[model samples]
Target: MTRSCVVSVGLLLLAVSTLTYGQGLLVVTDPDQVVRLPRPILIWPPDRPVVRPEPPAAYKIKQLEVNARLLDQVAQVQVSQSFTNTGSRQLEVAFLFPLPYDGAIDSMTLLVDGKEYPARLLKSDEARKLYEQIVRKNQDPALLEWMGTGLFKTSVFPVPAGETRTVSLRYSQLCRQHDGLTDFLFPLSTAKYTSHAVDEVSFRVTIESAQEIKNVYSPSHSVEIKRPDDNHATVTYKTKNEVPTEDFRLFYDVGKGKVGTRVLSYRPDEDDEGYFLLLAGPKIESKDNEHQKKTVMFVVDRSGSMTGEKIEQARGALKFVLNNLREGNLFNIVAYDSEVESFRPELQKFNEETRKAALGFVEGIYAGGSTNINAALRTALAQLQDSKRPSYVLFLTDGLPTVGETKEMQIVDNAKEANDVRARIFAFGVGYDVNSRLLDKLAREGFGQSQYVRPNEDIEDSVSRLYRRIESPVMTDVTIEFAFDEKHEELGKPVSRVYPKGSFDLFAGEQLVVVGRYKKAGPVKVTVRGSVAGEEQKLDFPAKLARHSEDETAGFIEKLWAVRRIGEILDELDLKGKNEELIEELVKLSTRHGILTPYTSFLADEDTSIRDTASNLRRADRRLSALAEPSGAGGF
Candidate 1:
């Protein structure tokens, strides 16, 4: 508890700092200083308190090409950008590359007229001082605040007028997984930082997995996916002379086992601490598993506040769940306002006849009256008394409890007491008026998750996405156990941390990735234990551990572990409120790993913190300059 609190405190502090420094750099220009550039050479958004000084010379991106390969769950990416001096005269440019959190740069090269220039990496602390020097000289505090974020900065390079320079960066990242899907995100929405769009931008990704590749989907951009077989797929995305407005996001599924699992480890050297990523999921076949049955209770709030589009969307969502209901599954819907109404008195078997009747009940649901969340949840929980089968409660609300036991905690407590069976409660909050904290608490206590839908988002989509994953759960109370033997003394303390912490139910077509640190690497034994159809079932698999490589193939594992660990800690911080120790540790983790959190953002409100940061940056920059100068000279 002490350790956890300290970590949380650190994160809160980091969040506060991030917000404060995020105000942006106020660029200042000195008529005498030719060394200073008015605008950032990189494409990051201007820091707050933004100052735009017309540059003596202008630069524009000509083209960009991104090539990526996914070997297992890790991705090796190369980004090359072409920049031309669009303005008159020769200009010295400070090239900047915004790096993904936890991403490590392997190599960088600058081609000025096809001749390579020298480049070096700077740690965050050193980079922070560099920004301070620029901000102090420019009188732009905004520049200093966000300057220290994970970045790859190259030395000043000369770009001749009408000449183009090509910059190529190579790096690697560990892709994260959720519910059997691995997502790769590229931060390509930099056109907003520039005045116009680039001429051409293209990206290609080739994925190879030990297990068969199942699905390849990209939601951000139009993409063409080619799959020669289940084990390999290639995706290509391109745009011609268009503004880059959104980031590129791709999600894919891998493996074919009923429960797909893979173990990846990374150690820096032959004898050092390492990290591991554990990916597991049920098979992605379209057919539902017949070995298990489920009882679903949908408790939806139809308060007067949900009279318009919200209620209609809710009805459509209910209809979707009914249509997707699996055979032999038991289901019911309970709609509540000040008064409670159930579609059926008891759980009804899912069939064509009952499905039609449920749709009728959904259509008859008219929004009116105040909210009675406590009573509504109680009524739904009462129907989930059967422990012989897996059960779930999909709760939706658009408002807080307004009538009958309005206290949020009391309502959650009462629902907990009513639910004797270990049923998962998936809660959804519609629009901003809903109490997110209450829903989160309810879901957490009920061994489930809480989702919030903004006013602009469709409720039907959010509910349907979740329903599809839970529609066919193959295992309940799922637990993973790792064993080590004397031959593999390097395996260390097997599992350091799991995001969800304890045992969780596993649904078909869904995957879970567990990230943690390990002391050594070698072969290890892993066992997955879960309850299937109320019977205990277990499977054993063999996995091998590895060390980190300079090629970046396995280097991202440590950073991936840090990301998941930080997310888990942030979730805890949200539930437990502010703790000094936790905030302190969070800051340490964020600073070391370059992970950004809401509490530690670059935007700011307080003046004292900014002043202190600026002062420190100035001192550090002076010291750094002194160290770089010749022994005879005071500074460069």
Candidate 2:
């Protein structure tokens, strides 16, 4: 208990420092004015909407190629593109890329109009997650996708006539701190025409960004050299000797307040990490697209660890999902501590009475025993599989799995085997004590997603989201069939990358981009099969196949999944028996991509405790830097 207060104080102090530094940086740039560019749009063919979103319909893609290489931990992306002005009007094209919390421009080489320009890096805006969330809660998802966000920005490209405009952008970055999780958010500062998805390659991370930027993890080496003007020479490292994982965000703005947004997931064809770009002043709104045969089972971990607001918050979330349950939709409730209890082991039809009853059950839930996530999942799954509808298993927990299947891997394998077309498990890792990796893997393997619920987070918001995903299934039986023959196929390819999506991972947000190479020009068909309600439906999609070289095949999709999976793999280094080559290569790719991998964990945050009195001696240097010094006093 005593240790808790100290840790909380430290987190508070760290958060304050980050906000201070963030504000200080934003203070330098005027919010109302700055050089702005808008993101280029994609021209997607007309087709029935898949469970995922359609790619941007503005940028007519010509030819895009990406190359990736890695150094220790930093990953670099080298993008080559050919874009044509497919429309009549003069178009300004830009690419908006997400930036991690702590990152900087290592180097930028741009070829614009046959002239090269080196970009000066500056953090133009900083915002609290609080404000972002509030706006998101009220904003339209489509507007956010097309407009702009806090970190989202656009690159400038002015094209007229039907001529093909070729652009080469080389951006590299180093990082300072590390956060366990980072959703790179690229904000749009202006508006412009749509562009193409050229190539995006990644390498490895040399350092982390969080360490240099905010620092809640540990101390990192940072270099700052003031130049002639406001620009400064910057290089930050999570360790003494290592490159840094710094992200580059590109933005294109429609100067007169016309901007666009794209809220999507990485490797949209598959379920990768979520990626989004926001450009407008409007807010984002949550949605729940009702689907057929939906059942939501909330398995709550009411352990003593969740005594105060946590329990109350959980109750609110429980009530929210229950209230949202549509008529005739099936649902159940389960609360567990050391033992497990379900409101109904079988699916119960949703009605006014049923919702009231479920709320009563939630009210009766009180913190009691040790966390038994295994039992909770099993019980919830059993309840979820009751009906053939797309059943959602929402598990919330704050402690390690005990009682049943304590081993995280064991639980994951069991849950993976347990998942059927009817059931998808969504895990919520609540508080610091929960084994997030275990829950995360469970959700991934079970066809849902994982989310972290900090102690301060409201349970109502999270659970309501679960209910929404439980209902929306834009297009089911999502399957991808590569028309290419055996040569181009990897040793083992994923048969299909389909899953039920929710509000944050919205169906309309994720872009379904299926990429594969074929040997011959013969046509191929992709057959998909899934149930809309309880009835099975299948569709065959035909498209022309092109042969892409192995080199070309390893582009954005390759690097995006690699960077994402490599981060997960690094987190489980203790498992052992993994390929050293893949790890090493992944490290290099991450470095080039400005992505943090296992080798780059140190760059996320600083570990210094601001609340510890014993660390009073450590404040000497920070104190000096905190106060604004007179310009003439420092050897001027």
Please report the candidate that would top lDDT against the real structure.
Answer: 1
Worst 10-residue lDDT window for candidate 1 reads 1-10
Model 2 residue runs over 4 Å out of place are 1-291, 402-404, 420-422, 484-510, 513-529, 533-555, 564-636
In Å, residue 319's CA in model 2 sits off its true spot by: 0.9
Q: What is the C-alpha lDDT of each candidate?
A: 0.63, 0.41
| Tens digit per residue, CA lDDT, model 2, 1-636 | 000000000000001001001001101111223322111112222333445532221233344333322221223544444555544554434333333212222223334344433322111111122223423443200000111110232333344546454443333322111111112112111111112122222222222221122211212223222223221112211221111222222111112221122111222222222221111111122234434656677788898888988888888888777777788788888899888898976879999888888888888999978877777777667544543456677888877876766876777766655554446677776765666557656765676666656454566686675465445654444443434345544433322322122211223222233322222333344444444444555545444322332232223333343334454455345344467776665544443333333332111001112232122211223322321232100000
Clashes of each: 45, 121
TM-score computed on alpha carbons, candidate 2: 0.46
